[model samples]
Target: MKAAHFYLLLHVFSTASVLVNAFDPITTTVVVSVGAALGRTIYDYFHERCDPKWISFNVTGLEVDLENKLFGQHIASRIILKAVNGFMSNVNPKKPLVLSLHGWTGTGKNFVSQLIAENIYKEGMDSSFVHVFTSELHFPHPSQLDTYKSQLQQWIKGNVSNCERSMFIFDEMDKMHPGLIDSIKPYLDYYDKLDGVSYRKAIFIFLSNAGGESIIQTALDFWKAGREREEIELRDLETLLSLSVFNNKKSGLWHTSLIDKNLVDFFVPFLPLEYRHVVQCALAEMEARGLRPDQSVADQVARDCVYFPKSERVFSVKGCKTIESKLDYYT
Candidate 1:
């Protein structure tokens, strides 16, 4: 035991000596540069491997890594599994899965997709079945909208013949051409078999940023403002009416000022988990990565966004209230 201890001490001494006198100044400089390059390379590697693949920085001021950090705790895995099962069960002959992205103000459409992807895949889900397209910037290239319709219809007829339900998730669908809405009218049938096709199958999901009522409300606001400002109400209402079913208030449509009931039903909006929920998730994610929430940063984030993190209620509520109390009240 004494001899073993001696050897261990000697080994430790040798390691210390090696570290202390490893390199000359020039050699040390070269080594540091090389090490920095290697560090950057490793960081890049991890960054690419993350679920979002977009998080380059960490809350703790350290490098963020997806492949290393996002193991076994991703949330999206369950969603896809359930969606797959639902599609498989309801579909007599397994239809192509089409998931849409739709939500209104403060919705985390991209983040939701990332969570689902991270849950299932430590790396990334095979994107063939999963497409993450942003509706915000997808301005159709000239006549490409027509081309997309034709090709999609063709694909549906040819490849997706066996699929009972096709799941298509579209986000910010309001940005898409109005005519594009009419294109997918054929696939609306899920329970009823199409003509001679002897199967009940397929899910078509269209996620949009514009909700039924919000759009109506926004338009109404515009119309009201226009009336007040002496602008053209007819043209503005025409644009709103173009998308909605209610024309100057119809059967059960005048609930809100922005959108009609029929248009609301057309693209069912997937309600977002609240802003507080989003901040909570982000905070939790940061905490999981070893960044203890500092009051200064948390306060700034809360103040900037008005979103209190609910995951750590004690922290968020206390911090927000404290900050609020500091502000001078009006006389």
Candidate 2:
């Protein structure tokens, strides 16, 4: 039988089984249990379908996650919350929401992406409507650029066609072949439709380590001058970040039309974590693993992380990336 018909039959059986409990409790229990298992199977089968039941944007949840779970990124947190809120709230966006997150490793680029995904789709990263591409894994061969471009275009077109609200995330963009990303430029553009498919409602996120050096240098400069890191804003880093990413040969964005055409809606910068932030990460990890937050353990883990500016040691070199493993060793 059709899945939907089966689902409806199971729903009726579950409701009717509840009534049977008065006559035969054991039979009713078995019927209810079997109905529930089949119902779950049916739910998973249709989970990927594009509809309000499966996908809904929760702006407040996203804000809370970014504020509570994310550490040491006031600028990134604010920009992402606003950008995503505005985009999801709009019924008719001119183009797809494009976010290019740049930062040193472990500074929460990937984490922020996960938060966004969780808030938008019930299944988060596991949602079929959400797609992720890694540079080294997906497009490791420069010689296969032509083949990769064709496959990528088809992949995106196919997925977007399946669901207008699909999300695409590209990780390790710095290692991506320079021209490979340009393949999706048309989809990110403001075109109403390309061959009868509307991509305006889709979202594209690019995460990269490119332009991180400039971000670190700026943060370092601010620290050296004794200015509060919170005082540093997007204006101080946005322009510099775009220039650095565009000029850096290894950055997947180098000389790409994505930057030149202003297709990237935001170039969010994640600042390096400080000693205190690393400690917070350690504590948070312990709590996540159901362990009591130990200040001593957090402190030891923070101290174990290598810090930069050899003499000053102002910022974490790994940026809380190794906190989980370190916590394992300590606890």
Candidate 3:
């Protein structure tokens, strides 16, 4: 009887131990599940806050009309529109669309970029996907070059990784630190994958006055040689403009691999506007202001702008930048 009782006690003890192990701590299990739930919720909240929703855009007839309406950049305008249209058509492209717009002040470099943003995005200038970085505003100090470099890289990677179709416009690129500009080279690379980011569907536009002189001189040469302004092709100045932008030490992209690799698909030159284009601008502004555009007013506004080659006939030097402001004087 004692032996049987001992065996029974042993079995009971073993069963109790197994039961204890199986249900060790219900509270611990509940706490772990709740912790995991909270962590996921926090992660989701930040992810939604940080990453914007990007809508697929289509090239519409209205955009084409706007391109035509842009004055004095016949070849450049066509090239920009064609590249954007083609890029937008492809849902997943193998490469990004990189365009460098080089020209004189007020020749519509910024204006063209804005027009593109307005047409391509539903939010127009306020689109979250359209990021415009100005040199003086975004990266002003030379001492902050390294900081800007890291910030720029993160900004590009973050935005592009979230939405590959994002558009980045860097205005006054001629004034940005060369090092800061060079920091963006990796994003423009021909790689299919880069650091968990695919930048093939992104669009980058660099606007600057770096190659303005070369472009203006080329146009002047064509003018003096009796070549029609309509006959001017971007190929006429592409090689020279690229060389000028790259070789110039003051250029934002000085010695950039992007320039060396021919990675920039287009160097769209905004030629200096002639007197006629300025008149078109004045009329457009007047119409926009609810004033009936007058031919004499437009002519006077164009005439007031200072021009180069003072010995020869004058052209609109500022290309309608101040045309709207000057219209008040005429009216």
The lDDT values for all models are 0.40, 0.94, 0.81
TM-score per prediction, in order, is: 0.41, 0.89, 0.81
lDDT per residue (tens digit) for residues 196-286 in model 3: 7889988899999999898888889899999988898978899999999998888898888888988899999999988889889988888
lDDT of 1: 0.40
lDDT of 1 by residue, 215-236 (tens): 3344345444654212323333
Please rank every candidate by TM-score, starting with the best. Answer: 2, 3, 1
Candidate 1 displacement at residue 158 in angstroms: 5.1
Model 2 residue 9 lDDT? 67
For model 2, state the Cα shift of residue 163 in Å. 0.5
lDDT (Cα, 0-100) at 238 in candidate 2: 100
lDDT of 3 at 184: 82
**Which has the greatest lDDT?**
2
Q: How much lDDT does candidate 2 score?
A: 0.94
